[model samples]
Target: MRGVLVFDVDGVLVDVTDSYRETIIRTIEHFTSRRVTRDDIQQIKNLGGYNDDWALCKKVIQDFGCHPKYQEIVDHFQRIFLGENSDGLILRERWVARDGLFEQLAKDWRLAIFTGRTRSETRLTLDRFGAQAVFDPLIGNDDVENLKPAPDGLLKICATFPGVEVVYVGDTVDDAKSAGRAGVGFIGVAPQQDSRRAELVELFRQEGARAVVDNINELEQVLK
Candidate 1:
């Protein structure tokens, strides 16, 4: 049986450094009037359990001595990310999939998504890339009771495939923990250009990832 190749959307299949990451920075500044850096965001990501960006943003705002309702943060984040007129930071995202990458991977492994993005967010990118057909059982945040670092999403995919070997490609420490808890193999993505590359690589190694690659384009060789 072909193994399942599961992917985390942000930083794995799509580069969200400018979109989602930027949204977090913008959200924090909007609430706190303090311009935060990606390092601020990465610090929280490194600590894990802040998979929900809204939750992370709220924590950042609180650190700056502002207390906004969770829904307030969520609303502001969506405005910046999705935009009021459909022209938001989300459009700034760059597609990471190279030509024929997913097509080739699909030949040997079934592809699926288990991401922090809502189904609509995932679909927007998939539709832009014309990649809706490439992934099956696209598990989004709303699909599960718990998000990453909880094995819920990975277990859901495994249940779908039924006994197939499974591998998860993800970018953060939470992603590794999610895979580990689900008893699935994991490949960590830490691009060479990322300022936090060294830190992420060490964390993935500490988590016992099967392998760590810079990006999904390199995933083919590791899967071999």
Candidate 2:
């Protein structure tokens, strides 16, 4: 039986928090005319949930009555969220894999990416990182109306690669829930000892995650 390992791109594989934070701040400043602090961004994001990413962002910035349409917001974020310059507005890290990753992972499973990104952006990032070779059949923002914390994308992936054991690895509670919602096993590949790490592990447990490890280094023990 073929086994499949589906992954989330942003946090799990690529550390883009800085870029994302700046993009949100810029988007808000551009449309709302109100400056947002980091705390404010977290509050809005935590409350809005995954499906509301774009819509909530627009709503927060729609105060000037000069708000652009959804596609325009999409265009704006895409243009700003990608790059490798440290002096850049956002702190987006390169999409390099964690150490000893492919050698350990690719041997046992067919890999794929399900990201909350437009196809063009996702493709570009994947291409830039040289990770496209590892992930086949990429699914992005264009593929579905709902993303993580919802299961449609992963289920779609399972359907495409029929009969494979599905293991969806990610770095957040939303990912764990999405995997569970899709009836697949979830693995949390956390990289740091953030305060939220334990909470995320517990959350995944609550959501029925098969394993929650600090990194993919623990995967072999769990998968075996």
Candidate 3:
């Protein structure tokens, strides 16, 4: 039987350093009136439990000593990310997986998505890349009661493919923990140039990750 391969959207299949991460910094500054850098965002991400970018934005805003309404922060984040008619920072996102990589992987493994993005948000990228039909049993933030580190999404995907080996490819500590909790194999993607690369690689090791690659293109070798 073909094993199931589940992937995270941001930093795994898509590079969101300038889209989602940039929105986090921009959103915090918009509310706190103070500049927030990528390093600042990295600090929070390194601490984990921040799979949901909206919640991460709220926490960072509160850390800056501003207590804005959660919904207010979310609205601003959506404005910056999704924009009025999709002309937002989200357009900056670049799919990171190598060309033809997903197609090749799908031949040997059933592909799926378990990402922190809302289902609609995930679909936008899938549709843009013309990969809307590549993944099955897509699970997004809205699909589960709890986010990463809770194993809800991974468990849901696992439930869909009974008795099959399942592996989750992701980039965050929360992702690692979620995979561990779900008793699924985990492969971490942490780019070498990232400021948090070493830290993330180490954390993935601590979580007993099956392998840690600098990018998703290298994942094929590990899967074999």
Candidate 4:
């Protein structure tokens, strides 16, 4: 059977260390007027359950004793994130995979995206990278009622391309959990940065990841 490969945008295909991660930290600081570290944001991310960064920002704001209305938080977040020109917050995404990797994969398998980003934001990034045509049935947080750790997005991909063996490639525990819930195979991509790779491998292994690769370049071999 031809395989179906579903990808998570941030941290899987695109490196978010300087983009989404920075936005999360900056958004929280803007509201609370208090500094928050990337590690702090990562802690919440590691805990899973938070599939939306806006919601995550709100939770952090509440934890810091600031209860801004949801709309207020969202507005502030978009201002910092979308910036003056509506270009982007931290436009520093680098591809995790090697060049031509996705194109090569497309030759044999159906490729799609399932991400926590809203459709507009996801489209912006994809367009920025000139990768708008790479995926089919692209799914974002807006496409479903529930996010990661819930099978809604992955289930949608499966239904769209039924009867194929679906494999999800992602970077977070939530990604693994969602794939597990959807009853699909999962491959975990740990950060390529030295010790973090080892740490994430262990984490994904604990989550029952079928295989954990330290970098996206390793995926070609693993899929073989």
Q: Each model's C-alpha lDDT?
A: 0.91, 0.71, 0.90, 0.83
- Candidate 3, number of clashes: 0
Give the distance in Å from residue 176's predicted Cα in candidate 3 to where it truly belongs. 0.3
Candidate 3 per-residue C-alpha lDDT over 1-224 given as tens digits, one digit per residue, 9 for 90 to 100: 47999999998888888999999988999999988888877778879988788898888788878999999999999999988998999899998877799889988999999988889989999999788998998999899998889999999988888899999999989999999999999999888888878888899999999999999999889988
Best-performing candidate as measured by TM-score: 1
TM-score of 1: 0.98
Instruction: Please give each candidate's TM-score.
Output: 0.98, 0.78, 0.97, 0.92
Q: Cα deviation in Å at residue 59, candidate 1?
A: 0.5
Poorest 10 consecutive residues by lDDT, candidate 4: 191-200
Lowest lDDT sum, 10 consecutive residues, model 2, at: 82-91
RMSD of 4: 1.8
Candidate 2: stretches off by over 4 Å = 33-48, 62-72, 82-91, 191-195
120-218 per-residue lDDT for model 4 (tens digits) = 888888888888998888999889998778999999988987788999999888998899899999999876663445656776788788898876778
- Model 3 per-residue lDDT at 42: 75
Per-residue alpha-carbon lDDT of model 2 for 102-208, expressed as tens digits?
Answer: 76788888888887777776776677677667788788878988766789899899899777799998876677778888899988775564544555566668878
Worst 10 residues of 1 by lDDT: 35-44
If the candidates were sorted by their TM-score against the true structure, best first, what order would they fall in?
Answer: 1, 3, 4, 2
lDDT of 3: 0.90
